[model samples]
Target: MESETVTKRKTSNETNKKTDSLDDEEEIGLKAKMTLINGVTVIVGAYCYAELGTMIKKSGADYAYIMETFGPFLAFIRLWIECMIVRPCSQAIVALTFSVYVLKPFFPDCQPPDDAARILAFCCICTLTFVNCWDVKWATAVQDIFTYAKLLALFVIIAAGLYFLLNELQDPVKNLPRAIAISCTLVTVVYFFTNVAFYTILSPEEVLGSEAVAVTFADRCFGLFAWTIPVFVALSTFGAVNGILLTSSRLFYAGACEGQMPEILTMIQIHRLTPTPAVLIMALLSMLYLMSSNIFALINYVGFATWLSIGAAVLCLPWLRWKQPDLQRPIKVNLLFPIFYLLATLFVVIVPMIASPVETGYGCLMILSSIPVYAVCVAWKNKPKWFNKSLSVMTTILQKLLMVLGKSNKPAQV
Candidate 1:
């Protein structure tokens, strides 16, 4: 009887061990699957935005609308700021934070104080900026390639999502104009203001903002399939930043090399083929701004500038249409498209002014802030000669002093 009992016990133990092994294998498999899904989703999302841009361009609304309302100078300024400063900074902060946040729940003990988190966020920003500035070649090779892939992937994801939302779900409200407007508006505000605060405040040693959407998504969807979404989002945005940095660096380099900026900005490290000085300068300025009080206000100020610029761009459409009517248009807007674009631009322009007192007091502040910068750049360039040269010189001196004392660099310079 005792021998029989021993044999049964051994058999039971073996079975339990096998079951445990199987469970482990299943867990690993699920994780792998989730990672893949997450990556794909991010790629698709990015792709959707790319497609949207293409659509906007093709519709011919961007140029025609902007030229008509804001004039070329303002339109150009708007494009320059959005492309060089606002979008890049915002995207970088969001991407990096979101990526880190996605891993947070997995390592619960890693959570730090808000201040500490913000500091770490600043470090991340500095690190990435340093990498981009350290060597143009290295930055170009690693960052740009990854960014292209990311953009392609995101475009795919977004297109797929739109399709799914519109077709697969077959929701009646998918095509509703009001719904589209609301959704776009929300996304625009989130995208615009979040980065300003992120660059201006959260880059320091303190954590101010909430964990990113990607991380939030990860926590909400603990399971494999669900967790994948956030992972993909992180990947997509990370790559997007890579691309933004590449373009931005080149723009700065070109400007500086052409004598449009301070001579120090043109310095390039021979070994890394990077703009070490430029990167360091930019990182310092961004950090100082971030560490200062009322970072949110600065962010709003930046947002106001960005929106005004975009509005100007929208207004340019009519001028471009008239001046370059014979120019080849890759994308053509319908008769109604310009009207729609103008209306949207008007709404964007007016809403902020109306909401400024209650929300940010940002409407005129941003315009005032840009005046000096624009004046200086114009004087330095001296091509069109729109603004006063003396004012430009004064503003430039003040800006330089602020940068020197505060260790801050403009995104445009970066």
Candidate 2:
């Protein structure tokens, strides 16, 4: 009973994992070239991230890859947009979903509690922030355990699903049109990490258009409880939240550490050995986002924005290669790779306009609107007095909060 809980909870059905049975059938039925394209897309993405990471390593600055490739102005703009808007919106969506899935299993009617979900989401963000403030080591230690447990949970799910499917169905179900759809579905599942973390079940509405294959099969074959799925879903999504929180906070702290942003954001708790102020700031922004937006609506708005940001960064690969040909690259993906990659990404960004114009337009507008704000906010020349003063005050507040929570309040160093 306990083992099968997660399979019942997440309805979108990537957990369906659809087996290699589906993929083998799809390959035989669909044109090999089509499957080849989707398969290569995944490979290219993996290669691209590796190339980007190498650039970051060789450059030795957190933002150096962008700065060296695109110049300081573009670098500053990317920093402002990412830190101020993109990461917060993303983190909020993750937090909200974490709350929804965590609360969902108890409601067997499939109707999750919206008010409770919202409150819990808000509290989850705050609690994570509070724990990190109290002690970074303790918070990370807890997160590490959850991270492993998440992997174990996923292993349990896939293993169970596969065991049942393999034992019952020796032969693959081959259907031509279904092949194309499943292929696309598989690609989407692998492409978007957030899919793991949903309002409407995309697999049912968009991919399978019915009850998930795994769900129906599990019911008929194993007669498992309907409640096993959400727990594992929650476990994985919670791990994702922890990852997002830690990585995003580090971006801001490192930005401040490099003098790219206000130094107050750089405040580290000596006792806790964490960036307490930056963590709190991100949590507060995440809380604000949760208060304001609907989960699906936020996902829609962020989809375009995130892909745009990612595309911009990915496009930098060719620049880094061209400008610094002499630079030691751990892995070099050719110029043509990024060229094709950019076109592929352009299609991804443009598709939203055809499918959902209003949401995608608003998203693009939100990203574009950052330009003038970037102009005003980034002091490429001299530090503004008010900016410095604000940092001093915010730093003191963050430092005092750290002390009040535990350690003696000596002047906190940024």
Cα lDDT tens digits, model 1, 309-331, are 55455444445566656654444
RMSD of each: 14.8, 11.2
Clashing pairs in 2: 5-228, 5-229, 6-228, 6-229, 7-229, 9-229
- 81-127: candidate 2 lDDT, tens digit per residue: 67766777787887777777766555544546778888987877777
Q: Which ten residues in a row have the lowest lDDT in candidate 1?
A: 196-205
**TM-score to true structure, per model:** 0.52, 0.73
Best by TM-score: 2
